[model samples]
Target chain A: MSSKITWPVPDPAAPPEAHPALVSAALSAARAYGEARAEHTRGELAESSRTGADGTATMRVDELVEGAIADTARRHRVNLLSEEVGFVDNASALTMVVDPVDGSNNAASGVPLSCFAGVMVEDGVPTEALTCWLDTGRCWHAIVGEDTAYRTSGRTELDGAALGLLRPHPEIGRSWWHLAERAERVRVLGTTCLEAALVAEGSFDAFVDPGNDAHRIVDLAAALVMVPAAGGVVRDVFDRPLEIDTDLTRRWSGVVAATPELAERIIETVRG
Target chain B: MSSKITWPVPDPAAPPEAHPALVSAALSAARAYGEARAEHTRGELAESSRTGADGTATMRVDELVEGAIADTARRHRVNLLSEEVGFVDNASALTMVVDPVDGSNNAASGVPLSCFAGVMVEDGVPTEALTCWLDTGRCWHAIVGEDTAYRTSGRTELDGAALGLLRPHPEIGRSWWHLAERAERVRVLGTTCLEAALVAEGSFDAFVDPGNDAHRIVDLAAALVMVPAAGGVVRDVFDRPLEIDTDLTRRWSGVVAATPELAERIIETVRG
Candidate 1:
């Protein structure tokens, strides 16, 4: 007996500098999220994963948003590699890698902190990225090897620096406490893509997954391009190389930080 | 070389069903916050507590918003009790208690999760309350003993419930881990009032302070009236009576839940 989250989703204010395909994809994702909110209650959206009458899995909000992005890819005539759909071939060297809804649980649960994260990869190299805050319609765009409109906090230490983290993994609870104790401030925003955007924009000094190994390629693709463009660095806690891959099964503990020194510090602490 | 958080603060969408004073105060807070964002950079706003050349503490984003709220109280001719500015007497029986900006750090940091929370009290009884998420302009309003438009999730167990929490305090970190481990999902959104509103509306199963005793009267003031109207209960972990009080020095560990049984379960788990 609950109502749906009724907040209106505004249009994406994508920067004029962003790629046309990325901008179009973000708009499509926003529309799909809005439509879902309008038609379904929070409970209904949360229950979209049940078996259908035909014994097939029902589409959740994530799949619905991904479907919209797929339509955008079709119009743009680019290949798509997304979390839910895996890969859709378009006979093009350029691929649009995306996490249609970054925090699918948050999106379905009516939390306003989800994101649309996409990167344009040319023959396995990410050339540009766009990440949009779906609720507020704010967008951040970045191209490889180019200066961005924003910069990181440039913080080099963990003490007195604001930190963002994924929720603790029960198996690694000590490491969670270790980093939380060292940081002067900590936030767990429940969305890795949005938290990474905050780090790129200097709102947060760093965002990390403390030994969780919970992020897929779709989760870190956009941050890999955007954070470095803004003078920050995105790394895996285990020192694994981050690249655009079509393997949806790969996972990493992504760390998006204001500076390389701080990223190393976080990795070391979590590992210790 | 970081930029200010440039997101616009929309006008509060205060429900027509609320007391005029609460709505007016929320509007004033939003306006003041917007003005501060337009006029100052994030680093400058973050350093607002410095002693000025005139030997006075500088006006912070928090103070600016509170000043505007005070002006609204003046216009309404009601007594005001707030966090930053302790209390203002208007020779009237009615008082407006507010946390001018609930997530002050989140506000100045441009995290887009801060809120304006206000409660209208008559002779120390909170008769009505209003909460506005400053980022999205969505609002929740409720009068004591009146049914609200939304209802809680009615979750009776913590095993699979989604939970929101305040950041961890080092001294009491075990309690934080205890609750986080038991919950099926956890989020630390860094804003108590907004998180409480999520619990009230069934977006989150519960929001708790985890024995930190970090909640001031202004933080939980709006939740006391709003959640109960929406079929939830807001309580203190230590079982302290919550009421309208002018003493800003007092604190409580707040537990806001969808049902009475769930509230008790959380309190017992945290206390253990």
Candidate 2:
């Protein structure tokens, strides 16, 4: 069963500056939550079979991570919107959207692509975001209009430009053909959250997930904060502006997030 | 243009323990070659998009990796059978099969799903093997019938159980759908060599690649030795034994590497 979350829309008159100290505290909390869950994920993956229908072990890891985040949110006295456990703490100065494990399925099989995502919302707008790639020990963080950075062993901001693209559903089969025709060296990584984080670092130009309705909010919430903070845009398939307050629990079918120019070019390529 | 490699037929009468240290030296040489190439794979991936229609950059990385392995084989005074460069030092005491970087495409995409594979042959029979997942810093190794152990950040041993399935290609549609119907969670990490190593570790039930024809002896060579050494079975989809000596440069149409029983089962699943 699914449920809707209600949020108090921030007033336009509310001050836009969210506390940087609070953002720092949130980042630390997110990192701790991610570290604790990493051990559980490793053990679960080790004991689990790849082909079994019972993904209980995987779910248990997700639940534990979610619980840890929720506990931390309560301790921090922050409202939380989490993928595993929905919204909590209705009225608070800050709101956190958490995805305990973004690539749950991949983590279950010991695939090295899973991550933990967190985004902070202030006054009904995303203010800060962070993500940690579990296996790689890579972390990315962004504060809107302030700074965006990626860190593994040390801190640095990505400078190279890589484009992200979304192929329309109608173009799925023919898309590769078109890619071949355009001589585009494209890669489909299959994890939406990871792609979005890449967009924030300016390492990737765009991210296109045609059906937003299919993926859970845990994947997109952090991306929502990161992309715009890095000067990228996220929109619907028909190229309509996205509303942050929309019910995020459901999939957003046909979404594209990219640099303005690249997004337009990708849409044009698909249309052609 | 494509070429074929010739390998010596295994001589059952030859001493099994012959030239163990030579195999070790060859393995070490292979590792050095792989490590060198891995250092540059990231840069290659960063530059893949800028490559022209002729795929000069892709070919360049392949040639560079292949060249290093050939040089290493020369230095070690061992015969070499490699994926990109084919055969060298044909009549030496130790014949090393090497894949400098498996998952070339993934390595070219910053996917971290690539590895180096090496197998040592004596009298045409694989005697020892080493496979290293470059990104994770995990290595799986086996020397003849001695216990096979996997070395990662944490150490683990294959229980002689579990199947590791590779990519199961559908005759049609997305090659991924084959995994959807299974009771087990399907994992596609995008690197053929790494998947093969997982089979060697007994961490997975089987590895199946139905439609892709990129499985070369050099790619599977190292994993094949480790898997069989760990008491697992490895074979092609036709239930035929994977012949490591056959034209090493050519790729197989489909492969199923697992316990003998699991391999048969997966083949049936593909056929059904």
Candidate 3:
């Protein structure tokens, strides 16, 4: 099965340790889940009557995808840590951090800016990551040791930089807007994984969260691997390393940027 | 030519005076231009060496699209009011308010949330409007007397409504976040026409601007027609009517909502 999985190596120097078959299984599961759900209307899919394993309101689509992904992971003998089903312990050493659907509101509302992401972690470190955009069916992935498929824009200034921001809670809205006002363009696309990918691919110079524990481990898992692999910086708001335990309840306020300088500038702007 | 263009009657009551052929020609032009530009990368398309007709930095893709739109308007014998080329007088009663490439920054940076919008105004009142999502090629249109193709979500409360917000400047950032904090979700997709269309189609409950002169005639022209046709309310922040002159220099702070109740709630939230 490991031999059957083909991973593209953009950087020949860095090959990942997690078996490619595990990543392939996750991607195939996500694609299958997304395709099935795409046929339904937002109205049919958006009912939040049930609570997820993570304690947030769960939609029908969430349960559907989570079930499909968990089935795939079990078949591949990989452990799963996901939003809807919490952590499913398996026999293998590798754990897949997954968000069956990120930006549920956007997906439920037909906003076309949601995605499915899964990151393979081995021995407490993420080895490989994959993000599949649900609307466009475009997928981006990176292994920590491989050459990144994309590069950051190398933009160091905020004056005219394209920035992506997540929606802020009332307590942090002011702080969020302070940083937003300094940038030439600010977009809040309502999806963290896709927004982080935009920064990694240079579509956006940065993707910042106004200081609140708004993002969970599942949300930032793929970004933690993809951003650094693409020559971008992913850090917490306080300049702390953006590592968290595999606990589903743990949350982080993240800032993913094209460069370290831009990341520091964002930190200063929000703190100041 | 006018006889050849058949406008679909979503509303049997609305018999627009503007010829359907004019609207068809404009839509075709936008589609053609978008398809041509979609082949290039964001890096290749995002050069800002030349200034646009509106005194903002212009990209080569913008010029290409704007020229194509202008030529189409000229061929159709419609007067033009646009962001790129300003006003072009023609020997026709119908003036097409156009944003050749709305969300230019999004397009240039490959954000996939940009559009082309054209509204046919006779005697300063918008009669027919068309908005084409550039990335997806999905188009929404409405004539004043016709039945609307979509409806708003009719959510009156901000607590859990899907809100679309424009990025606010420093002067208005506080006011913007004040309203943003109350909403269940806030999205800043960076294109006025498409955002407004989302509101009109029930995908978003409301689309608001933080109190500043952020939007121009070209931005709101299509919304002014589409929102009302879809049974939504559009008004300025001051509770004034959202009517603007044909002058490209003029600007307004606007809000489009699924209901008058929601619009009033947003206005009160911002002002308070």
**Separate clash counts for every candidate:** 0, 35, 5
- Pairs that clash in candidate 1: none
Residue range A1-272, candidate 2, lDDT tens digits: 00111111111111124344333333443444344444443444334332211112336546655666676777677887766456777568788776766766544444445666777888677777667665554556667767543311111111222333332233253542343234223334445677676555433445555332444455666776667666666655454445444244355533334456555555565445
lDDT of 2 at B30: 41
What is the model-wide C-alpha lDDT for candidate 1?
0.87
Report the alpha-carbon TM-score of model 1 versus the true structure: 0.95
Identify the runs in model 1 with alpha carbons over 4 angstroms from their true place. A48-59, B48-59
lDDT of 3 by residue, B97-160 (tens): 8887788877767677778788888877788888877665567878898887477777788777
TM-score of 3: 0.84
lDDT of 2 by residue, B1-272 (tens): 01111111111111234344333433443444344344543344334333322223334445555566676677767887776556676558778877766766544444455666677887788887766665445556677778754321121212232223343322333432343344244444556677766655433555666645546667667766676675565566554456767465455534434446555555565555
**Per-model DockQ:** 0.64, 0.07, 0.30
DockQ of 1: 0.64
Docking class of 2: incorrect
State the interface C-alpha RMSD of candidate 1. Answer: 1.6
Calculate the i-RMS of every candidate, to one decimal place: 1.6, 12.7, 13.5
Task: Compare the candidates by lDDT and give the number of the best one.
Answer: 1
Native contacts present in each candidate (fraction)? 0.64, 0.02, 0.66
lDDT of each: 0.87, 0.51, 0.74
